[model samples]
Target: MCPVQLDGIGPLARFSRRSFLRYSAAASVVASVPILTEAHLARAQRNTLPKNIPPGAVRIDANENPLGPCSGACSTISGLIPEGGRYDFDLTEKLEKTFCEMEGFKPGYVMAYAGSSEPLHYTVLAFTSKDRPYVTADPGYEAGMYAAKVNGAKVLMVPLTKDYAHDVKAMVAADPNAGVFYICNPNNPTGTITKYEDIEYAVANKPKGSVVLIDEAYIHFSDASPSFDLVKADKDVIILRTFSKLYGMAGVRCGLAIGRPDLLAKLQLYGMNPLPIMAVAAATTSLQVQELVPQRKKINADIRQETFEWLAASNYKFTPSQTNCFMLDTGRSGKEVLAAMQKKNVYIGRVWPSWPTYVRITVGSHTDMEKFRAAYTDVMNSSTAGLEPMPLPRRLRETPFTHLS
Candidate 1:
């Protein structure tokens, strides 16, 4: 089928900043904070990110694993590359059943999506409505609110607790009829976790019919999470997983959604995604080789802890992150700091306005961190270069590289 026709879009469906913006603009229902000017955006639009750029620009903005994929997964994808013409049933079934076994989840309770994003977007579209608003933490996962807006559901953005974790009580109090209550554990940008018991308490008392989606996308890299026992017991909760972060399968794109059979079944309304043979092969192999994830998780934790030590010694006020990324208070415009870092070929994450003075940086390799530290020192020391350049985070659609669990 012609994909463009399916989106009711023309030949311009390719992924450039402008095309992506055009398609997403019509669907924005949530009131967004505008910050960038036409002139500023025009520069980014006109720039093609110099092709010969070096790899020194470590990408922490998108929360990607610096490790790309494990050896077995690499082999699997390499095996599948030449077979693009074939259906990927065997590999997909192997993945589904193996994931169920490994995760201690039932195969029936699981469904695979190329990435967690489509399922996130699809799940909201399938269940939410004008009367049943979508409730989430402000500065939490923007994807959920974006999904709710596409469906014309009211978005209630509750503020985070002073400690920077999701205010479970406040979120529960926001909208009783909420169709989807989203909590990103070890919440993004902040890198702090909300206890599993807290989530269970909220889930137990959630609006009688609403679904609680606990995104443990970063859980593998952290300590234990609220277990998948809820999904096993047929509770009204869904857990999302991806092979991106530690397993290094960001580009391979394999993600899973676990919940009660009925709620998982509701996903049928959106129809099945044709699992790419390549992704299926890579993800399935990644799951079978579980040691790789644990090893990488430890590496990420070690790197993160070391960085925290430095932050502490330097008297940097930063959020405590058990995961792979954390926010640092730059004491100034984070956007300008981000740009400054970029100019030095060390792209830290964007400036999150929730703490306008803070900057979020994804935990990169020790080598990358050293470069980042050097770049940061240079930027701070440069005479009269302390001001942050404001950026208008364009209302772009979700990252096309969405399997980012």
Candidate 2:
């Protein structure tokens, strides 16, 4: 990724070195809030009895892998419990090495985190500021927007193309002083893939000293090619990978940020905690399972396609998706449909302001999707007037930019 040189006279320069230091320190503390986790995001979206999620609720809201950790990963986690008292640094090293080998990346090009969100946030904080605006697709993942707001950076939300893919050209033209162009491939909420050519164009044409942050959190669930080759080419790009999706370790929390060592070094300014030993062990074992990705990909794809077909036959409008999640355009306010589904005990995902009528749906297992289909049909067939509007929690409503899938 391109190193953001702070030599010019703008926000980075005007903000004194001492002030920047204080800001970084304060932001680090803020970023550590536990509510930023994936699970908490679902709770924030629903604004219901979050602390007491119903026991038998068919929860397809979070885009979590319903299969959970594989047998091997479970066995690994169980075996590693006794050794959890001490940090297994080698396990972390082994995971990094194995991932690098699997992807043909150099050793220092990767660093592990609890989840990709940390690095994602850090990258935005490191590169963006008032002068250097953050550019992202409209209705895209909002974590980067949250980081941008934290850094006092302007956010330029570019609308996606007609097919719901990232409008790379429009993104490049969004702002000349753009510091980071955030792309979530098999993008969250929509689950649509932006073409590789579009990504390469963004990387090739982005402003000088700017970086393209590509989040591949759901890459495994789709057939689209990854952008790791851009890293190998030493282009200005940082690619994020997470075991939270197909590997089924959302709660376990293990992820990677791949880029040049210099780019990775910039993210360290925000400070990072030591790797969790249990997560490291589980992730290491998960990476070695030969058939895990292919097997899970087929399962998720099958269910997602089936759901799409049902929606099409029922005359419901939806975004055709490649990943485990897709957006459905309710004929009325998305919040009404969300509440209706909640009443039916089939919890779905949140809505983006850009698409007020579209509610995201996470493709769960066969039975979970079936429950979703029934609840969705019932909600769509009924009038939305009687559905109570469940506003987001106070904090989230106050800062609507923090809404992420």
Candidate 3:
């Protein structure tokens, strides 16, 4: 799609230096609120897990990398255990420097966090407000919406294009006073990519003072170009990266946010806690492994393709995903399929309200996926009697912005 001209925007165009300062000050106060505490964050993560997940269940949910950290990273973490007592070792600085050099970013263009989630939340809190709305793809990552609600910002959910990519033009037109445009490459749940050109269009034509937040959490799994170059060009964009996916450090919890120094500084007003010593050490070493990304990318792609072939042979419809997860359409209710799979000890993913009949399936190891194929076929062939579709909660069904004013 062609990029549209976004000239003649009024108050949004006047997003001056004074306006930034004022927004940042207000965001800082919101960040200090009790809801953003460390305990709350930890609790949220725990809640994503299914209760009483049985041991040995084929877990293809959560889009987690089955392969843990690389050998080099594991060794580094083991070596750094003794040094954990010291809070101010230069390991975190080393990680930032290494990432900057690797991505050709200038000094201070990147900041490390526990995971990409923290920076993602901070970006929404910093840029969005009641007047300035948060615009995101309808079935996109839900975390940003929650953060926007915390800041009392209007939430605009733009539907994806026919190809399952974010409709950049529609999103730009959704809200003239948009503060943050969140585009998740290889979007969660769907595991599909919004084209890089579309991202550029959104960046260039978005409402003035709006920041384009690209979540590249699954970028390594796909062949799409990284958005880091936009940061190098000093565009009003923030790119989030994490060691959790390809590097397999989800539990280790190391991630980075790349953007202009001024933009990143605004996030700091919310919170910039110290990095864990072991996670820093592991992440630094992981970056040094020359062949780590390509090797794991091949492994994941091959397994995902194999699973796709199986679904096709079984005459089931599925989304073509370049990442480690894909969506499968169950002929019956998705919740019923999920429950049947669980009965057979095969745990898959949650369903998005936008497509209640389709359930997400994370690409697991070869053996785990084989188990999934067996369990899924059995569930689909069985009777769906007495199985009711679970409706989404009212809070999740309605946009948070509607309740405001």
Candidate 4:
């Protein structure tokens, strides 16, 4: 990875001397031999929610694929039934190899989780302390910040660039105790990508012991490739991955993280769980179809572009995106739009207090986007839209925002 140089102008100049030192420390640890341990997870009883509940309402809320596992993955999952109670390290091993190849990294650099959120939480639990801090883009992903906050770590919130991509220099400058520097590529709500080099600099110039965690959950739909080279080069950086998106396997629970052996070892404080036979079977099958992503990327992109185009023609403002989703600037109360859509049987994504005029919209199938368009039109054009608006509870609201934009 091309490490970011800390001595710079514009944003970096804002980092206090203490903050610069903190960023340096973060970079050192990530670049060093293993020092951090993965924290342990207190296992909870298995979630028994039904797997295939139909979306009765036209739902474009979650960034989930409306259509589920591809035929190859579906068949493999069904085949795993016979060994439902068994543990197959062989299957897991193969899956790891597949993951390594796909990311252009090695097996040792890769680790598995039930979902990307698991590792996201563990990274916080393992690293943050009263003296250390958690730094991330405001109005980005929420799960990581909560983990850090509950762990008693200070949280440093950085604003995004005017264009919506992460302000990498600000993130790097907010160093010192910055335990983990987070960049959610094609960010969660906005779906914008910071240039690969900017992220590289943040990782390279961050505090020596600090870790840079890139949440690439939307990478499949995003045009940018993740920085696995940093892992291959043995730099202290973690790239998170998930099958939850493209594979439609959120219910099955599978995620991966890649970094140098030492950086990954930090997460080892949390012991590994025996592979779920079904998850392994399906994930392996999903990884086998290397071409499946490119094929679907185009289809998803076409749908996303069509929706954005319509929005543009209608004078709706949205964060220009390079992934399967984007944030729509409703030019009014997003909560108002949300309630209106809900009443019309269309529920889009979450709201951000930071951008009260914006609401996130996942790129669903063509028909679902059409449903959202109609509902949105009705809501915006109706008189009831003037009613008082309600927001998501604290947790949901906080996760999707850093500060008012």
RMSD of each: 8.5, 5.2, 7.5, 10.4
Model 2 C-alpha lDDT per residue in residues 43-68, reported as the tens digit of each score: 77664654445878888888899999
Model 3 compared with the native: what TM-score? 0.87
Worst 10 residues of 4 by lDDT: 39-48
| lDDT for each residue of candidate 4 in 299-344, tens digit (9 for 90 to 100) | 8889989998999999988988877678998778776776677667
| RMSD (CA, angstroms), candidate 3 | 7.5
Which 10 consecutive positions of candidate 1 have the poorest summed lDDT?
396-405
Which should have the higher TM-score, number 3 or number 4? Answer: 3
Clashes per candidate, residues 3 or more apart or on different chains: 5, 0, 0, 38
The models' CA-based lDDT, in order, is 0.70, 0.83, 0.80, 0.72
Clash number for candidate 2: 0
Task: Give lDDT: candidate 1, residue 244.
Answer: 68
Worst 10 residues of 2 by lDDT: 1-10
The TM-score leader among the candidates is 2
Residue pairs with backbone overlap in model 1: 36-392, 68-248, 115-403, 336-388, 336-389
| lDDT by residue (tens digit), candidate 3, 173-237 | 88789999999997876789888898999999998898999999999999877887789999999
The residue-by-residue lDDT of candidate 1 on 103-122, one tens digit each, is 78765777877767666766
Q: What TM-score does structure 4 among the candidates reach?
A: 0.83
Residue 59 of model 3, lDDT score: 75
